[model samples]
Target: MYSEIIRLKELGLNISQIARHLDISRNTVYQYGNLNPDEYNQVLEDMQTRQKKLDHKREKILSWLKEYPDLSGAQVFDWLKERYPEIDISESTVRNYVSYLRKEYDIPKTIHKRDHEAIEDPPQGHQMQVDFGEEKLKNAQGNLVRLWFIAFVLSNSRQKYVEWLDRPFTTEDVIKMHENAFFFYGGRTKEIVYDQDHLILTSENSGDLILTHEFANYTRKRGFLIYMCRKQDPQSKGRIENVVGFVKKNFAKHRTFFNLERLNEDCLAWLERTGNGKKHNTTKKIPAEMFALEKPHLLPVYEKLNSTCKNSITRTVRKDNTIWFMGNRYSVPLGTYDGTEKVVEVMKVQENILVISDLETKQELARHTISLEKGKLVKNNNHGRDRSKGIDKYIETVAVFFNQPSQAKEWLKKIRAQKPRYIRDQLQMLQRSIEDVDVLITEKALNYCLKHNLFSATDFNDAIDYFGKMQPKERITRFGEADFIEIKPLNEMDRSKFETKPMTRDFNYYKEILERGHIC
Candidate 1:
């Protein structure tokens, strides 16, 4: 072929004219024309020898295909592509080369990989791939729980981000995963390619694409487009599909977690250690290292897409007037003093604190301490016992006339039995009598009534009035010298023994009739 092209070029033929005559590449014709006749003859001989060698290899491939008709030509071509070092040929050329060999060596043609199309290359940063996988966990009951982990990987960098959540692969999880992927990528991609699920992209009976409202909002907010492959056509996002298998085999295999949060933390750490740490297969650089370079140039994360998740639940106060949180209950102000429904705003910070507030007005009333102990009810000890009404206050009230420690103890015990009720009236009655009578006599009356159960101050006053009217009663001014029997009655019978004289002076008849049952 080179000699023929050289001969044609010697006859004043251009490269295109020589290529037409020789039916070869223009460059090959040009090279042939540039060569001397001796060199051209040597190239033609080498080409003929190479063609013979290819004929032998092609005959062997064809013979193998004839013997095993199940074998595909593309499979043989793949083998030849790897086996033949000197041959640089396209599949078509190889096919034609094999056909010529079949004609010369008497072999057969086999099936070719004509039905399959070459995979299309994804545009850089144009698509994000997502999938789901499983991880195992031990629940509170110690039973094994299989958790679903949502995974997303950039098609270009193979930078993967994952989350292990107890919630199913629902709409919320899908949206949340997308949000996290954007943040993980430090920006948005031109398009998000996802598995065709009802949570994300669904087809209605009417043939309309029923995209989730939240996902639509996300796309609109981030200025990114969405892409969904045909059902079951996993090749649509083969990047993440392969990533899914990679993660399952490497990170998730034989792994056990106690909680979803801990697993997610581990997943992220693994992503940093493996996904972003190693050189990519195609790029020959670390995925994480490449991601860093790609991140700054990607579209910025949308400000409207909130990353926070809020949880709201209602709680009630226990009998101890404390609301339970986390595991413990802490006291709010007693009575919720403001009335109506009282609420506790539990803001989770370093620890959890209940912002005690009046629900009617939402006014913050008090801030209680954070609690963690389960079922632990923390009381407001300072307010539980009102210090203003302490035992000392009651003791000081009675210490005025009773000044004796023994009498004060007795009075305090009696008053405590009645609680704070009626204690002031009893103290006032004692102070009034202390001024008119000797302290000893008033103390005697108090002890007599306490012993005989005449706790009423009015009954004690009647006894004192009766004793004052006694006829010709010998009196001792000094407390120690006074007639002790008259001053202080020892028993109930003794108290009744001293009575008013019958028919005091002259009672009016009508007034007497009103007291007809009386001895007077």
Candidate 2:
């Protein structure tokens, strides 16, 4: 072919003409034409001869291949370099040589993966695997909201239960969900397996598992065995690993963000419809059907589980909202000093965490670490400077931007109460949101939030932009209909806790908004 191309090129033919005459491609003609006779002869010789410069190591490579069929070419290259440190050969060259030798000797590389056995399931109700998974879902407002979830799978039956949270899981959250899962599955398994999640296990001392103090207390209270699998051992917890992926792919994938309640409802529905209701791909058994056999074997769910704050002591709330604990006055959230609620129950959790709860309601109020010296005010960074009066002032100032100061202030108070930890940031955000927007729009946003019981500053900001995007016709039509388009709470917060005023406003703003789309 090369000779024919050369003859055609010599016969006053261009690459295309030569290609046509020789019945080959133009690239073929160009390729041969680009090299002179000596270079072309060298190329031909190189193509015909398979003797790599590094082919002398064929004996060693073949021996290694016979000894270790699973050895990778790169490993062989490393071995060669180790044996002959002075050998000058590129890794690619060594790889090529190894490839050539393997083909010549008919030795194919085999990968050695761990052998999987068809292990039988544990006795019915003996074990349930636990794991967590998270995904981001877009809400109606087109905001990216991430939700974390923990899933439980019965190893014997492949039965499943799952719960979701809009925030990171605390030990308390985990315990609560575990209780819910127990209720869902009808009973607790003999041993629950889990990944070494920091929420539960603090550290593994030698062979002993050191669980977090709160979790340890719960475990002792509940009386179930915990089997934490080591990191990276997915196979040990394969059942729950599959459940995690199944939840992420089957249930949570591309699902819209609502409240945690709705997400869990959808997940439970899916588990009934497909997750456990479907036949297992591996065992060829339907999980719900299998769970019937497993349910009776499960141990009875513990009755009368105590509040997570076990072994707690009552402490008097000082006038400063600090609680007396071991001679130190640690600050609670600013209104914990209300005369009606004079005391809080304090519990010492792991890592010196102080969990303060309402003495009567037992609802957790604040969590802080014991950091300061005795007699020094150990105010948690979470509870910042006294801002009740200032927050009211800030809310009023932001509300004044809208037409109804009292309504806006009440709505803003809802925001402050709902997001007490982030009140300052939320107020600042509300102020920024109303700064450049139209007053009618801010008022509409505020009313929209109030009407829908949306007490979030973020939601308020979204409401402003939501209204601002509409035409005057859309403004009036959308304003009334917008009340129906409520966003699911980012966290499942109780709106009843917020003191709201009647959504009564003067008709003049709407009368102006009704005019030819102008802010008259």
Candidate 3:
């Protein structure tokens, strides 16, 4: 206070000493310190009104400041300019008001918070961090497509690897990224970190590391330590977080990629040119320079790492003699073949390899090269032959025949890869001779038609049924019942009465019999 300063000066306080004590200017002290009684009273009143106005301003600014404690004064000024036009304000005015509120209200110091996972003094080659960022783009069709970009950074050197994916994040995606990152770095680090991806864990907040089972197995096999950031804590893995922005801004900015693969290739090229090649801000040496020191500490590239692969979950074959994977038709090895009740593991790990492995034995029973289009069924190999009218119907019949593999094996071996025509021929032959004989006789007959021409399994079945009904019945060994069998040729009385002509032993005659619909 200026009046208090005059009182202190009369008590022998020097101008320099009084100014410093009251945190005021020496000019102000000299002007007010010598004021007469009336003038000093007037000065005191003026000081009170100014102080009251300042106090009101301080309270107003502080009340607004409370809404955005982390915001800067300039930013607050901008916000106030747009939101509170009635409140006359300036950046300095807001700043001074906030300063006064801080002193008067005793607010605590503010610090920019970061995740505890970030190391204060990171050791070279000690840790590598991984994270994913998303970008929006228009594809060739001019439709918006979202691409996922995964980045890995070395803490000390800041060397990085970035890749793009068109699909949503998956545990498989995470593992593949790590594999490629290790290859890119030429070694593995002692510790690696990841975010809360479902493929990793649903929710890891309780301090329990609930990693996906597959991911756990993968890390355990590789002997790498994995750490995840606390939920909503970005500063925890600041190295990767910074690299994500750096790579995107520097490399991905104006560039366009046709697909995920091309985008990833571009990302790799950019990472090498920007993040890895440039000198790091904190390290003071180029990343390539600091990376050399970390090189030897990393684990040597694993030879078997090349074998790791991924397949999209699209197809599934169920246990009920039906195939239901990715909403497509795929045949099993046939007939209640219990390959363990576990879900079918469709191995799309490599290029289009579809392996149906038995869950219990972990043995693959069926495999086919899948066409690229999803839901397109490659006929199941277990359906060995086609003795049917059409390809699909033939597949269905073969599927039925294999329902009794042992019984069908003899027939199947003969017609391992027969065409529908041969099967149709066989059916015509079987039905022609069934006119005068018992149809049940034809049912039991095992006439193996092994030819590629008969691509009709349905025809083969009909023929088998026809012959099955024609044969004479021998006595049932188990039931002790004498089963009557149908005789195809004429008996003595019928033979003598009309010398009737039977079917000639010729393929054309069989064809004639089929055209006439002799057998239903």
TM-scores for all predictions: 0.37, 0.49, 0.42
After superposing candidate 3, which stretches have Cα over 4 Å from the reference?
Answer: 1-121, 140-143, 203-205, 306-520
lDDT of 3 at 42: 91
Candidate 2 lDDT over residue span 135-196, tens digit each: 99999888999789999999989999988899657667788888888888889988989898
| Per-residue alpha-carbon lDDT of candidate 1 for residues 366-393, written as tens digits (9 for 90 to 100) | 5667665667776666535464365556
Model 3, span 1-520: residue lDDT tens:
7568867988998999999999999999888878888998897788776753345445556776676566566765676677767776567976665566667776643768744543364676678888888777777777777677888888877788887888655556777777888888888888888876555653464787755445676888889888888878787777788888886678766566587778777777766777788778876778877788878888776754432434422223455444555446566666534564333434554565667655335566677665656676667745544324353343334433232435444454344345334654543443354333332332243333333334344655565665654533542322335455445655445555476678669789879989889666
Query: Candidate 1 clashing pairs?
Result: 276-288
Report the number of clashing residue pairs per model.
1, 0, 39
Best by TM-score: 2
The TM-score obtained by model 3 is: 0.42
lDDT of each: 0.63, 0.80, 0.64
- Rank list by lDDT: 2, 3, 1
**Model 3 global lDDT (CA atoms, 0 to 1):** 0.64
| Ten contiguous residues minimizing lDDT sum, candidate 1 | 307-316
